[model samples]
Target: MIQGDTYYFAVHLSKYYPFSKRVDRNYYKVEISNKSEPSYKFYTIKELSENNKYIEAVSIPPKKEGYFLEREEKHRNEY
Candidate 1:
């Protein structure tokens, strides 16, 4: 993942209690970081009745034009 970039991942949980098993999928946004060895931070995006104004304040802006597109193309070509 690119540093400071955010990505969505589907999380699945498995349970085995009372001889029962179930799977659930949840989406979470993961922000990439390099400040720590872990290299990433995760946050859950909950649905709200109105827009989340806080997101704009904390969101990371693109460094330049075509920043995300260039990264996508580069990653595609690498594979």
Candidate 2:
């Protein structure tokens, strides 16, 4: 198994937010980045939104080197 950096994301869903209707709960379209300059590589999940909700967290290994694999694209649709 490849070792990857960990990431965390949170989505708020309430009846009132900034005095507006609550935004529908959604899954994150994970986009991993090395965050470290000189080694920026990242990769995005193809289709795994349904699996994650509210707060999505995951660990993804580097592509080839220590560089982070970034996500190029992502699409969210109801199934």
Best by lDDT: 1
Candidate 2 per-residue C-alpha lDDT over 1-79 given as tens digits, one digit per residue, 9 for 90 to 100: 1246654232333323221223355422223332322122222332333335212333433345333322222222323
Superposed Cα deviation of residue 18, candidate 1 (Å): 41
User: Candidate 1 local accuracy as lDDT?
Assistant: 0.38
User: CA lDDT of each candidate?
Assistant: 0.38, 0.31
* Estimated TM-score for each candidate: 0.27, 0.18
Candidate 2, number of clashes: 9
Model 2, residue 44: what's the lDDT? Answer: 30
lDDT tens readout by residue for model 1, 10-48 = 333232222112343442233222232222323334421
- Residue 9 lDDT (model 1): 47
Q: Which residue pairs collide in model 1, if any?
A: none
